[model samples]
Target: MWAKLVPGKAVATPVISYMLNKAFTYLVNYWRTEDMESVKAELLKMLPHVQAVFDAVDWDNIKEQSAALDAWLWQLRDAVEEAEDSLDELDYHRLKEEVKARDEQEASGSVSKLKGKLIRKLTKHVPKNGMLKRLKESVEGLHKALLV
Candidate 1:
């Protein structure tokens, strides 16, 4: 599937995107109920948007790449949330450290090639309030830094 969608030859986003799509699809499919249709519709809408994001990236597919990374992070967040212990101070701090590492890599252009996907992945986990908000804010800060 990725051989053609991704321009300038094969790269990581396609691999990551392929995986993200599959994982998200699987999770949604597994847990989905009466609201499944709406959720899928929304995800369908995101396809072109994700594509447009790829277009804007120009090269190295930063948006798409980062987006993939972000997706992975969110999965982690969800997993953490589901755990009996939840995100304790130590865990939260570790996540922060990870985010910081990502931001640093982004700032130095280490992951610049994959920024759009990166941002997409980073922002997708925001849960609307509380602990999620703090995480969202941190990711947003990283997103802003990428633009600079």
Candidate 2:
């Protein structure tokens, strides 16, 4: 079977690593509520370990094993996509709540000056629930691959 190639050029390594770093950072920095504590902890733990593994890769010599590297990169990509999907589920819920809150405020007979205040809050990056177990498993799988 043909393996999908990863762009392992000198420039692409840094860019690829940067994208992974950004995704990990976003998950780590996300605000957490009580219900999210466990999931947040899992993400916080997994991301740094994954980052360390990614950081330790010999990017310059990667082309020597292009086939193997391609396989590994594809696995990483799949794991990253799964993580993003899981996080997006939480974002969906957070947005739904924001919209509901805004509607409620608009329906209330508040002061004229305060009419739009709630809507303004909706624009804020409300730090945000997704399948924690699935996300954890996907990341852990990537982590195991990195170990090899």
Candidate 3:
């Protein structure tokens, strides 16, 4: 229904959609993380359901809805915002690692080049375990919110 109004775009494409798009672009053009592939797939699988829920909302009459629904909406919004922030953090770390690697590579001398290569190998730009865990938790939160 929302898609028809937009001619080519779905009106329910909210922060989650943007986050997924950003993650996909980064994975394709800048960073590659095997761990994130599963997470991305989970998010992609949930996207249609999330969009449908969003599209079903009667925004014009939301103010007249039960307090429980209002609360649920707030929770969903918070989860979405948290997910966006986590994605941004991932992007920030990816860019930071990329820049650091580039700077190291720019250093002169064979020793420096070898050291740079070693460092890059040892500290590949994949998300750290802690960040990945947090991201997974965020996705869990989103799933829980949707179930509410």
lDDT of each: 0.42, 0.53, 0.67
TM, every model: 0.26, 0.45, 0.66
- What overall lDDT, based on C-alpha atoms, would model 2 receive against the true structure? 0.53
Off by over 4 Å in 1: 1-32, 58-148
Instruction: Compare the candidates by TM-score and give the number of the best one.
Output: 3
- The true-versus-predicted C-alpha distance at residue 49 of model 2, in Å, is 11
Q: Write the per-residue lDDT of candidate 2 for residues 1-148, one digit (tens) a residue.
A: 2122333333433443444444454445552334444543454455565555455556556556476765675677676566566656655766886777667777867674275675556555444323444544544554555555
Q: Give per-residue CA lDDT, model 1, range 8-65, as digits (tens).
A: 4333334333433433443343333344444334544444544454455444443466
User: Candidate 3, TM-score vs. the true structure?
Assistant: 0.66
Give the C-alpha lDDT of model 1. 0.42
Candidate 2 vs candidate 3: the TM-score winner is 3
Q: Candidate 2, TM-score vs. the true structure? A: 0.45
Best by lDDT: 3
The candidate 3 region of ten consecutive residues with least summed lDDT is 1-10
Residue 21, candidate 3: how far off, in angstroms?
7.9
Worst 10 residues of 1 by lDDT: 139-148
